[model samples]
Target: DTAVSQTPKYLVTQMGNDKSIKCEQNLGHDTMYWYKQDSKKFLKIMFSYNNKELIINETVPNRFSPKSPDKAHLNLHINSLELGDSAVYFCASSLRHTGELFFGEGSRLTVL
Candidate 1:
């Protein structure tokens, strides 16, 4: 079974549009996180949830929100998407705060 998965490997849209990316993990992990990889390829943690509880929010804009209904899924929703939001979003899962993570291939968002 796939450890983690994200939908729409590529997304292209114009500015001001809203978009959401779904993420799921079947590894029975308790923590899931959303990370953004910018044009420079620098990975930054956006949010993390453990057992459906928000554990971390790394100063991300209000335009970006993450929702986790359970231990195995975490989804990201972006409102009023802008060109600056163009980047690769990766969904990952780990057993706890400091553990090896399993990442999805990535969902590329292109806002023009």
Candidate 2:
């Protein structure tokens, strides 16, 4: 049983399009997060939610939105995709603030 899973490990689309990535965790954790890893392998936190409550909202683009229906799931939606948006999106979860995070395999988004 996977602790966390994301759909469409690879996604390729042109600019101006919209796409959504789904993520789910079975660990029953109370916190979930979305992270973006650029081509340089720099990982940055995007959004974090705990028990369906938005806890951390980073200075991300308005075109990117994160939705958490429950503590175990968080989905990402992007509008008007751009070339700069091409990166690997990772979903993560942690039991507590000081706990080590468990990450998904990541979804690669390629915007042409």
Please, what is the whole-model Cα lDDT of each candidate in the order they appear?
Answer: 0.95, 0.93
- Residue 90 C-alpha lDDT in model 2: 98
- In model 1, the clashing pairs are none
Q: Estimate each model's TM-score.
A: 0.97, 0.96
C-alpha RMSD by candidate, in order: 0.8, 0.8
3-62 per-residue lDDT for model 1 (tens digits): 699998999999999999999999989999999999999999999999999999999999
TM-score of 1: 0.97
Candidate 2 residue-wise lDDT, 2-111, digit = tens:
58999889999999999999999998788999999999999999999999999999999999988987788899999999999999999999886657899999999999
